[model samples]
Every structure is written in structure tokens, then in C-alpha cells.
Target: MPPRTIKAAIQDALEDLPEKKLDKFRSALLDRREEPRVKMNSVEGKDYITIAQVLVSTFTEPRALRITLELLREIGCSEEAERLGELPHEPKRISVISISQSIFAHGPSAGASAGRYMSGDKHFVDKHRTALIQRVSTVPSLLDELLGRGVIKQEGYNTIMRTNQEKMKELYAGPLNACGPDEKDTFYHILNQLEPYLILELKSTK
Candidate 1:
């Protein structure tokens, strides 16, 4: 028999869940502040199979399952993640929790690859990842700011939305990861506007 694909895994994971739980799962995916968010509407009245289809189509197979697991955790359905994990899977795809590193992965130092110096502002964001994750809350606003500043486009916004784990995590993984010094400056400025107190505290601690 072929190994269980992410779609099969999702069907299995959600098969036994009650209506309330399923609704919670659906709502967690849809709670993107406003305008329903891209691709979210497809899951509105979708069944597990359809929902899984949408996820697979949007984020590809591996990321689809990761997003499902994250959504399970987000909606207090952690046990669902475990159930999903128990299903047979494709060969050696990192087992479960295949999201590949947490939000604050101390990624490669900026200067390492190209021998280019990492800028001070970018360094600030990198150095303070932990504090930023814990303290930042004006996430939707921050995303808007980043988008308005051209730091991230619509696809970037949607990707971050799909990967649920405190908006800060998504921010780090999506746009912030690719941001240049000028973009990082814009990010920092937005932080000041949306999380003034937290930024102030973090800066003082530096």
C-alpha cells in the first residue's frame, strides 16, 4: 500500500472529531482578522477531505500537514496533531513536526554566505528574536505595516497566515527572513508604532 499522503492523514485525523472540534479547526484557519483572507474561504464549509485538498493546493503537501498540525495546536486540538502523526507517512519526511525549525531559528549569520557585513538594524531584529516573539501582539497591524512598506507582498501575507504560531513566528519565517537592512528598518519602525512599549523595553535592555 502507498504511504498515507497528507490528505489521507488529514482525513484520518479529523474523521473521529466531533462537530465542535471540526468547527474549531475551521475557525482557527479562518481567523485572519478581516476580508476573510486569501484561500481561507475555501475551507469555510469544507469537509476534512476538501479542507485537506485546499491546504495541499495552497501550501503543497509537506507544508500542508505542518500547517494542519499547527492549526490543531492553535485550536486546542494538539491531540489531533498526534493522531495525524500516527498515520503512515511518506518515506523519511522528518517524521512529525516537519515545519523545519521553530520561528526563531538563529539562521545563518548574514555575513556568512557572501562575506557581506550584516547591517546593525538587521542584527537588532536577529538578536532580539526571543523578546520580540514573546512581547509582540499587534500582529495584524504589523503585517499591514510590512505590506504597505513593500516588505512583503500578498502571497507572503497569506503564507504567514497559513503557518499559525503567534503572528511573530510567521512574520519571522515569511517576510522577515528575506528582509534587507532597509526592510528591517521598516520592520523596526512598525514595531515602534504597534509595540512601542515592548520595543522601548527591548532597546533599553540592549
Candidate 2:
């Protein structure tokens, strides 16, 4: 109910996710929080589990999940987030091949929202549509954080953003932009060759 208590509960939930995915989740939440309707607790006075929580619960390292609840307390209080009933199901898991097929077969953005369906974070999707849209606006900042962390590269960012002026761009542009199969192969080939050279240099470090 109190902001301090609500913030603590959220921090705990996030600490449960994979370390790698943490920044993206936080960045999205920070952006999502700008909306007045994005209440931390549900109408029944329970804190909702975020999509990031499901992703962490499903894919993060064992130690990473351990860190989530604790971190949440450090950030906010859990008592404020306690809900009245059972949380929602985790999102479904899809193989890399399935994701590729879906993207290539359909289009980049096609069914991107389905990640919510597959993972356990469906509660947020079902309850907070506007908040999610606000969160989507934070993707570029999340990618920038990932670049700063060295988890992904400039080429990855470029590939990720080329068509990102809209949703689903992350899935489609690489193959769609290809002149043909051979050209696609050659383009990736060139990108692979120069990846290390494109390392993102942080301005603060300089």
C-alpha cells in the first residue's frame, strides 16, 4: 500500500530473474511507472508478478533467482506487494528454432506479444496494457544498457533496431533485408567479420 513497501516487493521479484535480463526488466519498469494507472498492487491489494519475474523464474541461473526476492526487499517492501490469491501461470517456453520459424514464416513482429503467453508474466499483460506500451518505449534504453554490459554488440543493436521504429522489427529485418539467400549469408558473414571492431565505447569511460 505504501510506496516504500511496494517498491521493496518489486525489487524482490526482479532479483528472482536472470542477472542478464535484469537491466531490461528494470528499464521497462522504470518507463512503465510513468503511467498513472500502473499501480503496483492489484485491486484486491496484492502485488502483481511481472513478465520479467516469469522470465527470470523460467530462464535465469539458480543463484540469480535467489537474488531476486532479496533485491526486491532492498528496493521496496514486500508486505505492500502481497496479493490476495495465487499468482498467474508462467509463460510457455519456445525453442529457438520455433521462434525462428515463427518469425521467418510469419514476420518479425508477428506474435511477439505471445512471449507473454509462453512465459508466466501474463498477469501484467492481461491487467496492464497501457503500462506495457509505456514499457515498450524503454526497449532502446534497455538495449543500450546491454551494450554497456557487453552482453550484445553494436551489430546486434543495429540488427535489432533497423526496423524497430515499430514492434516485431527485432525478428524480421535481418533476413528480410537480405538481397537473397546468398546475399543474406554474405551480409552476416561480413557482420561476423567486423563485430569485434564495432564494440560500443562508453563515453563516461573516456
Candidate 3:
């Protein structure tokens, strides 16, 4: 059989982490809401609580996911009320679905009692792989747009194309498939590769 790919290797590495570690992480995050807030002092040396920062964090807190949904509904209500000078005449119902496929595209799911962690990890890997392809699909269009707008000069167009083609080969169209590279790492790689060409392009424009 042919050798397994790098993406598979990375997935195996991530999945092979002891379940004990995951259990510990889950336990730690469970009570994270009760953790003491970080304190800071103003320039005058008076202690102050960053209420706005705390409120933003609270809204996005793991414990506040449902609350955030409700708050979004509240905001929509307020907007409509301001528009009509009153509340909605008809009650509107909103529903949210935290679908597995969608969450897996970004990271591991957090659904408890779903038995998904065991299988969802694999789904996450597949979704991550597909995401890399979707990202690569943007490279050509980005290049074309840059060329069309004269952002990337015609003389250096070949250089940009060659660099992007190499990236495509590294990510896809190769025996070594890189399907599961995290979005952060993929973006980092893109920035690293494109930085030099971008610098040269900007220099030419100056």
C-alpha cells in the first residue's frame, strides 16, 4: 500500500492524545465560569474593573452560548422596536442549530452527551482538509484581482503565479495530501509565502 499522507499523520498525532487529557480539560473548563477575574490598576494606581471587557467575554463565554443567542434576539427586537416605535406586532420565533458539520469546519465540537468527540474528531479532520482546498481556491482569484487592479505588476505576475502554484502543490495535487492542516497554520503558511512577493510588489509601486 502507498504511504499515508502528512495530513493523516497530523490527524493521527492529534487523535492519539490520551483521553485522560481531554477529560481533565473538560473538568477544568466546566467551572471556568467561577474563576476569579483578572485585576488591573489604572495609571493613577487606583484599581478598576474592566467592565466592558468582562461583559464582552461573558457574552462569548462557554457558559453563555445560549445567553448570547438570547441577547442576539433581544438586539433584533430593539432594532425593530426603534424602527417601528414599538415592539414587533407579531411574535417572531428564532431557532439555532449548532450543526456538527459546520462546527467541525472550524474546530472540535463541544456538545456534551453527544458521543461525538470520539467520532466527531474524525469529522473535524475531514472538514479541516476540505477547508484547505477551499482556501487554495481563493489564491488564483486573489492573484487575478491583484493583476487586474494593477496591484501586482505584469512583470512579476509569473513570480506570483509560480509561488502560488507551488503552494497549491504543497496543499493539493500531490501524492502527499495536506488535508488537515489547521486554518491558523494554513494562513500562517500563506502569509509566509506571500510576504516576499508582496514586499516586492509594493516596492515596485513606490
TM value for model 3: 0.16
TM-score, one value per model: 0.44, 0.22, 0.16
Comparing 1 with 2 on lDDT, the higher-scoring candidate is: 1
Estimate, for each residue in 14-63, the C-alpha lDDT of model 2 and write its tens digit: 44545544544343334432213223332122223454343244334322
Worst 10 residues of 1 by lDDT: 95-104
Total clashes for model 2: 18
Q: Is candidate 1 or candidate 3 better by TM-score?
A: 1
- Report residue 206 deviation for candidate 1 (angstroms): 28
Candidate 2 off by > 4 Å: 1-32, 37-88, 102-134, 137-206
Which residue runs of candidate 3 sit more than 4 Å off their true CA positions? Answer: 1-135, 159-206
Per-residue lDDT over 92-177 for candidate 1, one digit per residue giving the tens place of the 0 to 100 score: 33211111121113333322243222345446677788768755655676777567556788776554453224677877877788
On the 0 to 100 scale, the lDDT of residue 5 in model 2 is 32
The candidate scoring highest on TM-score is 1
Model 3 Cα lDDT, one tens digit per residue, 52-74: 23323543332222222222223
Q: Evaluate residue 162 in candidate 1 and report its C-alpha lDDT on the 0 to 100 scale.
A: 36
Which runs in model 1 stand beyond 4 Å of their true positions? 32-40, 90-206
For model 2, the local distance difference test gives: 0.33
